[model samples]
Target: MRELDVAKLPEYVEEDVRVSEWSTVRVKHCAYSVPSRLKGKWVRVRIFEDKIEVRFADVIELACERLIGRNLCRIDYRHVIWSLIRKPGGFARYVYREEMFPSLVFREAYDGIQVLQAGTKGDLEYLRILHLAASTMEADVAVALSLLQMAGKAITSDAVKEMIASSSTSIDVPQLVSPAVRLSEYDALLTEVAA
Candidate 1:
């Protein structure tokens, strides 16, 4: 029998996380409908053991980790992301403008990411953020994740840009997370950015 570490996959990556014997799953292939903004930035998680690894297009060469439980993730990022971008009243996208420039935003969650959470409540919220972010190329969650990866802290897209410019590592720019997420999901975004 085989198993997956559900601990690594955060919310917003998929609708739900189903842990089962690895042999029970058909790993033939899986694909996600990501937003245009995230074209070159999309990746899929796969479990290798106790830890999870993130890779470009589910390919092993781009593997970002070699741990456990990372493979178990959401199939679609659109569902959750749409929920956040839809606005508080269930309509309209929140737009923040910098002088003539404008960008959208998305929130992480109230509880936090799976790894940071104590149980399902917190994990679910993070899952929501991850799923939402993964669904689209332009979600605020994407930028938030990118920021979390580099800055070692959570902040808005605009703030992330500032950090990236300052880092000077010349590493991969996480991704363009335009339009800050609505509400104060900043804390949540930061918390779940890694897992």
Candidate 2:
């Protein structure tokens, strides 16, 4: 038998797929999130054994690890965050709702919000908190959630927003002192060089 040339094989196979209304592209029976702006648009998907690369207009936009099983999904909260902010009602009933929770702390915050405010109110509140986490540093939001819970305060979106605002440091540029510089010193150096 002749030796097989492994080098000739392509590193990855590319397939064209349309991004669904759900802001996802399906590959091998698995769904992967893409930016919501790409919805209903055709994108090139490069399928590797361990991951998938999504490209739009020849520009690589997202790379996510491949999901192994049928109907499995990998969702990034940032991908659909803006849309969720506009329509927070979908958060609780979204087909891939759990995937939107970035961490256990976020999930806990949602649960706590639900306990405090039931039904769609809680969903909308949690979505706002998710939006805040997406817009700012997630660790900060998580810390705020922990503090709110420990303080026995209502874990609403406005409360989280207030906490985040309070914890952030404000810088007043006018308060900064600038180092003094003397132009006369430069003139003295020039005179010495000429002498």
Candidate 3:
């Protein structure tokens, strides 16, 4: 038993990979997205059984669930939203376009926006909403979109932003005032106990 190595072996396989211009790394025939800032940079990928950790400059940058099948992709919209916002036309033909929608509400909002403004204009508006979601809290944006849809209001990024701002402003939290603690009462109790 002493001859056996006491140190534990790493369960993950490590590899060095370069981030593509699209901010993705191909691992085991699956594409996993990294942050846009890591584009064209070499990163260390530690592939575990269930997840993969991407590291740059010895610091962990991204951790994604490992894809099981070939030609599969795990694309995070936040990683690519900036470029898509710049070129809204590319959204129509984006290979992983469906992955761009963070949730059903976002998809519905896009459809609604398309109904209001067709072609590239709708795309731009939807991209702006997505950008808002990526930058701000997604749940907040989703709630704003849901509220706008419920009210039968036109769903635009600006409308969602306005809704969010108004809702945030309207929140009323009751102030809690803690009662002053009395040390004299405790002293009296002690005196009574002594007597």
Candidate 4:
């Protein structure tokens, strides 16, 4: 394979590969998107110096299922764009045009904190709430982070909204909304990729 532009990329890449369950694929070179659903499936790749392709959805599914219940590791799901690269420091970052949430990463990192190493109920509570609220576009992350420090671990979304509605605190929250967000609505994103 030779280096080529986007117009020539498809010619170099092909699709429909398969893998067994509980495995990982080595996408050692280049940058491309993988279907989001391929998160845990092991993928067998046929790559050369210039061109590469992992082009199969089933392969992704198998790998992702293998990773179920595992700690904070990167898994690529069967999303529209399913390309991956093994990054420096061995931290596999799932790169796609969409489904870009760092909160999951943050929660994992938070779990690694020394204080939370033993994993207390309070720690998990604080982390989950902070994680959920942090993903919200209107969430006051600074306040949430501070609240965690104040021993106010987590407030359920229902309670949090009611607090805001009742003006219990200065924090202002709007009406109840869909927990799932549509990618089309993100202003900062230039491309649309589904989770």
Per-residue lDDT of 15-93 in model 4, one digit per residue for the tens? 3334322233434422333444555554545443454445453342322211223232343322221122212212123
* Candidate 3 TM-score over all chains jointly: 0.86
In terms of lDDT, the best-performing candidate is 3
lDDT of 1 by residue, 116-189 (tens): 54454443444344444354333444555555745555333334444445543556777877986576687778
Instruction: Work out the TM-score per prediction.
Output: 0.23, 0.82, 0.86, 0.29
Scored against the true structure, residue 133 in model 4 reaches a CA lDDT of: 45
Which scores better on TM-score, 1 or 3? 3
Error of 2 at 12 (Å): 0.3
Q: lDDT values of the candidates?
A: 0.37, 0.88, 0.92, 0.38
Which runs in model 3 stand beyond 4 Å of their true positions? Answer: 1-9, 183-195
RMSD, candidate 3, Å:
3.2
- Model 4 TM-score is 0.29
Highest TM-score: which candidate? Answer: 3
Error of 2 at 186 (Å): 18
Q: How much lDDT does candidate 1 score?
A: 0.37
**Off by more than 4 A, model 2:** 1-7, 170-195
- Summarize candidate 3's per-residue lDDT along 81-149 as a digit string, tens digits: 988898999888988899999899989999999999998999999999999989988999999999889
